[model samples]
Target: MRGAFSTNKTMGEAPEMFYVNGFAKVVPEVQPNHVNNVDDSSTWYEEIIDDDLKWSFKLNSVLHKAISEYQDIALLDTKRFGKALMLDGKMQSSEADEFIYHECLIHPSLLCHSNPKTVFIMGGGEGSAAREALKHKSMEKVVMCDIDKEVVDFCRKYLVANKEAFADKKLDLVINCAKAELEKRKEKFDIIVGDLADPLEDGPCYQLYTKSFYEKVVKPKLTENGIFVTQAGPAGIFSHKEVFTSIHNTIKQVFKYVVAYGTHVPSFADSWGWVMASDQPILIDAVEMDKRIEERIKGKLLYLDGAWFHSSTIMNKAVSKSLKNETHVYTEDNARFIPGHGIACRP
Candidate 1:
């Protein structure tokens, strides 16, 4: 399988969960009481907490060691990150995010597309999105690329729920930087899903969110009718009126239409964003989309359905209302989204 992939911010009584390696080694703590620091096994954000619960602390402390060091697999805490287990073997949450993030990211685009068959997913280390994309009987293939192989290894070793998603036969797993992978493939997909983190000034992923890169590296890869969907940022905290406007503005330069969507992840209260860009005019018919998704999804689920899509729109509007006009774009180049900053763009 590709790999495993939380939150503690809600009104209800949060569940009891913990963060640990596959072998069940406890993750470290950030503030200990409010938030615990998991060991640095994965390469995303810091200070993961069982925020959903009444518990004082929860998180693994594994440092970011090389892929060779991770060992063991076990369920640490379910209440913290909403994940059934924590893994240390591979370290990336590509698979988890695919189901959790990618579903929310891609389905909207697919709904907007008149016909979507071939797809490309960049930065999906866990292959969860690849798993979801396969649900469409009409889909031909899903090509997913990620820079870290270690994340995939640990997730395969630790998270069992993600096994099917990562092992899907139709998926082409590319263990390389997403931008580099995109450069090698030209106009090959009808839909492109970008699950990358905020761009860094100095890193392989920096180009994924750049204005220049989208115009050059990313745009050319799309088919004439393709729609590009991306996790923009935490809409809740980043109400970056400019960044959001800029993102929409930037994509409009190439595509005829650019829009945003939202999904509430308790783990990242103010740190979620998704952008859906397309060359054709788009409209989301909720009634039809829900029926399609319901017919496609097989297993049981506590969240996600047509109502979820409606809620996503509401959340986006709420975030938009919260943002000030002078706000700056909150990309990976800056710090993670802080809750009170009005920049939470968690679509």
Candidate 2:
């Protein structure tokens, strides 16, 4: 491995009586309830944006830290952000405001489809994506396939907010590489979500973002009008050039209609991007979208309704121009990755 890569929100629960792949024997569980604020080896953490820039956060304690077969994991109690989950040194989501990121990543594509019944999530191990998808009355099945069982179980045990979601019968949690799981299945879905981690050098997640995979594996698994959506890394004025523009361009190569939207996520400490694409027309009428949200989904949305949906798609001038001019197509050999990992503080 080149180094540990950061992800947005691929975390989840351990299954009962389910065959967990690669587990010859079950591992012992540590109760998350026992994690205390006074015990820790670090008081702060850093998110490296690049060589010259970074973001920092203060924490009450290091709740849990470990190295799984796939990556480094940390569960933290932050001073202000409630509880935070970090993978490979990068914080994924915070308890205080993860709803913002999850809502934006999921709702637009589901609402865009006339009635999205079946959905496939590539890597939302945290169960937040599944939690959001199950709220839709039209949803029949939501399959979540993540490559790592360690992180999934970790999230399931500690992320108490998503407890009900992980237990929901609608979610079919599969322990396998998304590519392998997706390709093996004969069925197609109304929406296929790339609730995946940001691409990093030598990391296993980048191939799913490539043009060839969209044209080959992903597109074929979707229904005729199926929509494919993915998290497109950083999209701020300073960071848009990194992976967002390139991911957008790659999806554009395979789909006729592509829309890129962004929102500033506080825990991420930067603006984030998500790209939604489909071979069919993705209508953007705020009124229609609002109507669908009201009809198809249960409960009130904390963020992302028709009016906000309309505005979020309107990318900034620099990012708009950058998307139009970006030439990079994400490929296995030629891909751009978000350039930072989390680092524990030193005293």
Candidate 3:
């Protein structure tokens, strides 16, 4: 499992330029570089890199107006770790694990409820969430809000995997700061999906992680019996292997019920985590969803299906037992804790 940011630097000579996480080094690399989106849809970084395994930070990409363009990949440096724009591989399409992540984010709220027609997406400019939201034949309107315009433009240009998902005429794509944009809209949504980063601080995403922010700014926007969902963090990095638990506990304080689920992403070290909360319980039948996915979109995928999807929800015995035996510490005052050492949200 990968760890969060610490003060240590891998290279002693460039202490301020890089951050170290054991052997995996994340160093600053972006400096006054202009990205020319190649082949209309995808872009490549002209800067030379000796190794492909290491992560590099784009210096010019400040927290607000930063973007990273790589071959088959792009990242918006939104202060924290940034948003990933995938063009190729299992991570790109709505197949397997990626499908599970996006489907779970959209479906449970819709299928579990008696009525769901309108949906709002916060920060899924790549169109995956918007695409999945449109899958429901009952859904009437789909609103998408993302801070960076570059992500939407890049997806429309190069990511063909999302062509079917975003082609819907009912989709309303809004390129604006999600927090501020959602504030102005008087209309509430039947389901609200937040695809933003999980960081409590570090980037523009800090506000989204706070309970005060959600209660005052986000919660009231939901329709009656409306369900709210979002991407939390990795279990290994946040709460044992159930990273969304921290967000789950936080949301439970605000909403009526909060539950978390997991998915294994190839790009992430210990897969990824998701948090879904509502005034009611969400009993997702992955088996049924799988049949629907197969009937709806007939394609080969990497991480999700009936079997894998069902297995993902089952807590790993090792991780579950470890967490139960150990005490994890977390507080609103000191939310940030060391990663990968059991649970740290309680301290």
Candidate 4:
């Protein structure tokens, strides 16, 4: 809830010097006579949430920083969240709460399907999505396609939790744009996951969220009983309409049964939304969902369980009404990008 660092001057005082830390470098906001007035306690990382708002945290330490072809990347350790990953100045994942995100993203759709033997993950460069998918005893093959090899390599080297999943025999990792990769393949998947970056106006990921891509490319590549799921951005009471409602409405255009759900992610500072769709009706109740979790999954899910999953689907009145009334169908020209997203792509 901290305000963004300011350089504006006071009425009679000298120019202000604000220092926001990045990759261990404490660059000072230098002005007349204020160049040397850097405060050591001001070493924090800040993310813009809106024109008038920002979020920041005190940095314990910074591990890495670099600019890749697709985006800028950083790794930092914090007292509150453990190790954290940053891309394009936006928080991607935090060690303390990442399990909540990864489990929720991969488990629901996979468990809903009767037998999900083959799975495809788009842009799970961190290997967390593949890790959760592989835990299902029914999985035979899991393909993870990410456009940026650098991100994948960085994750492989540093994300110690997913190392075993990356080395597993069933995983087929590919470095390519997900859309182009899916188009080239003749094989189909039982579950397809969009574990992608938020759709930013400057990001290349906006097209991947469009109706054209879903119907023309993604829908045709799924098996008859297949399910498609994607993270649908922020679902806070004041923020759900940015992408979540429109994403649900757009998918309803192509699928027979579609459901939008959400859960609070502490690190994200909002309730994150997800949309799941399939041709087959989802008939299982919470009790049945729990039974499947016992029989199918290898380890206990830290964040999601049958009861929690059921509750997540029951949206608040405001979001429910917005979803019902939404008319937007995502297209290249008409797409909506998250306003708070960091510039994650060149185009």
Q: In TM-score terms, which candidate is top?
A: 4
Cα error, residue 19 of model 3, in Å, equals 13
Ten-residue stretch with the least lDDT total in model 4: 1-10
Off by over 4 Å in 4: 1-42, 340-347
* Residue 179 Cα positional deviation in candidate 3, in Å, after optimal superposition: 1.6
What would the TM-scores of all predictions be? 0.67, 0.86, 0.64, 0.89
What is the Å distance of residue 313 in model 2 from its true position?
0.8
lDDT for model 1: 0.55
Report the lDDT tens digits of candidate 2 across residue range 1-347. 11423322223432111111101112223347565344333345555667787555666767777766666677878887988877765667899999999999999999999889999999998889999999999999999998879879988988898999999898999999999999999999999999887886545587889998999999999999999999989889999999999999999999999999999998887899999999899966999888888888899999888989889888888889999999999878887877643222111
lDDT of each: 0.55, 0.82, 0.57, 0.84
Clashing pairs for predicted structure model 2, backbone only: 11-125, 11-126, 12-125, 12-152, 89-342
Clashes of each: 67, 5, 16, 0
Tens digits of per-residue lDDT for model 4, 1-347? 12233443445543343633332234444456553655743456666665676676667877777777777677777777887887766677889999988988999999899999999999989999999999999999999999888888978988899999999999999999999999999999999999998887776588999999999999999999999999998998988998899989999998899999998888887899999998888647889889999999998888888899999999999999999999999998999978644444333
Query: What is the RMSD of candidate 4?
Result: 4.7
lDDT preference between candidates 1 and 3, better one: 3
Q: Looking at model 3, which ten-residue stretch has the lowest summed lDDT?
A: 42-51
Candidate 2 yields a Cα-based lDDT of 0.82
